[model samples]
Target: MVSLVPSLTEAVAETLPGTLVGATDWCSHPADLDVTRVGGTKNPAVDRILALAPDLVIANEEENRAPDLDALRAGGVEVLVTVVRDVPQAFRELARVLTACGARSRPRWLDEAEETWSAPAPARPRTTVVVPIWRRPWMVLGGDTFAGDVLDRLGFENLYGTHPERYPRVPLQDLVDASPGLVVLPDEPYRFTAADGPEAFPGLSCALVSGRHLTWYGPSLAEAPRVLAEALRAVRR
Candidate 1:
């Protein structure tokens, strides 16, 4: 089996060790894995992957681009594409992947996370937050992205989640119009550092945050709600 993402690699390895063939180096997954780091500008160990002759290649539909998928298919590789944005979608995708690969997956922590975080609660003011993936243009999760839902659980009103599309392009003026209480810049798809937060987007209540837990959409989300909640608590007051 071939895995495309870091969380998936970790999950597959944990679920079925020695089954996963190899993983990409620059996919920006949580560290600690048996992987070969191909340059960010280069292809993942494609030669080695081909040699492995993986019966099935598992990849996220949104995570892997069309060109890459086309190439894989053209090469006579069997690829399973899974796209998951919400909790349900995530579960569905996970189940499908595990079953196809005969890899076992029990979402034990998903239930624990839901019972712990998704339980009903008293109402509070939804904190307005803006998540920036890039600074020059200030792209944010506009609507229906996994990051948008992560903020929703924190009683956060995603100022941009209501936009026309997922991962919409946010002009600086539009962000200003949104009037966010907290401005969060991520470390992946774009690297937003604590120091960069000030120089790039000044006059905003900003912080640099790990994008994995927020953006990753596997069992890893079991950790996201708690992790994000901790970060929000520190910054909200």
Candidate 2:
């Protein structure tokens, strides 16, 4: 796998084990796979793929850097891009994409993982979560983003419901005044960590979470829901 934007790349590495390669600034996984270091607007690793010459290369149309993708295509590579927008689309596309790429998915991984979230009970008071991928100034996920859908499924509402765009940047003061129940900093975009959460957004309950679990819509979805279920439980406390 040549993943310039992380997310599903980490999933492939973590779940499939030794199956990932060529990760960028966005990827997060165990340090076993021989990853090509490419990040911060410099893709030094694209030159490396020519000799390996694999059977298939998978990418996301929206996330993977385009120039590098074009370079790969120029090398007579068969590139298949998966653009998954929602949870249902995510699951449906996974099997087809994996099969197309000749990758076998473990049975029932998607359904079993998604089922980890109990149906939201009226009894469980909702937690308003803000999934911040950027916070230098501040950007939040709004409705219509995959992350927003994930939060809804996990039994929470986006505090930035009024924001029009899927991913919008706003002022930090407003975010603070919104008084989010939980401030979730993603591992990518902003790459916020557990240690960074409180220092970044002081005076709010915060947690660090896998951005891919909430945003990556691919075969990774099969495993992400369980990761989300675990995070949701923790956020509720």
Candidate 3:
């Protein structure tokens, strides 16, 4: 099998080991993963992937492009495209994809992740927050996104959660005008850092978070809540 999504690639590599014949360069987890590198998620080397002759290629609607997957399909490679918008959907789709890939049984980490997130959240006043994924044009997390759901479950309300666009590009002034209680910045997609993103939001709190834990749905799910909660706690203080 070949994986196009980094999270799913980690999932496959960790769960099935040598079954992953090829994976994109972005699949960085399980650091020692010694699979054939097909290239990046958005621009995979189709010819290299075709040469591997993988029976199945795993992809996500958000992380991969249609043309690339279609090209693989045209080459007679079966492609499984997954759509994960929330934690529940992530669990459900992971189960489906793993089963379809002939998993002997459910991975224990998946169950642990479910249990970890399923536990009741402490009742607290929800803090309205704006989570920025990118910064050049200033894009933020919006409605129906996994990160938004994760934060909502943790008693943090996304200020832009109702926006029509999934990751809406808004002006810096508009974000400031919204007057969110906090600004959450992740270290991927844009690499927002302590010295970088926080400067923009002056007095308001800004949380520097891990992009993998915030958005990935693999084994990272088990630790995401804790990792994110710690980050939020520090920012909230």
Model 3 segments more than 4 A misplaced:
none
Tell me which residue pairs clash in candidate 3. Answer: none
Better of 1 and 2 by TM-score: 1
Model 1 TM-score (2 dp): 0.85
Error of 2 at 82 (Å): 1.4
The lDDT per prediction is 0.68, 0.65, 0.91
lDDT of 1 by residue, 17-75 (tens): 57776676654444555554432223454556667778877777677666676676777
**TM values, all candidates:** 0.85, 0.74, 0.97
Per-residue C-alpha lDDT of model 2 across residues 175-229, encoded as one tens digit per residue: 7788888887777667777666557567788866777667766446666666866
Better of 1 and 3 by lDDT: 3
Local accuracy of candidate 3 as per-residue lDDT tens digits, 23-134: 8888889899998999999999999999999989999999999999999999999999999999899999898888878798999999999999997766988899999999
For candidate 3, the clash count comes to: 0
In terms of lDDT, which candidate is stronger, 2 or 3?
3
Candidate achieving the largest lDDT: 3
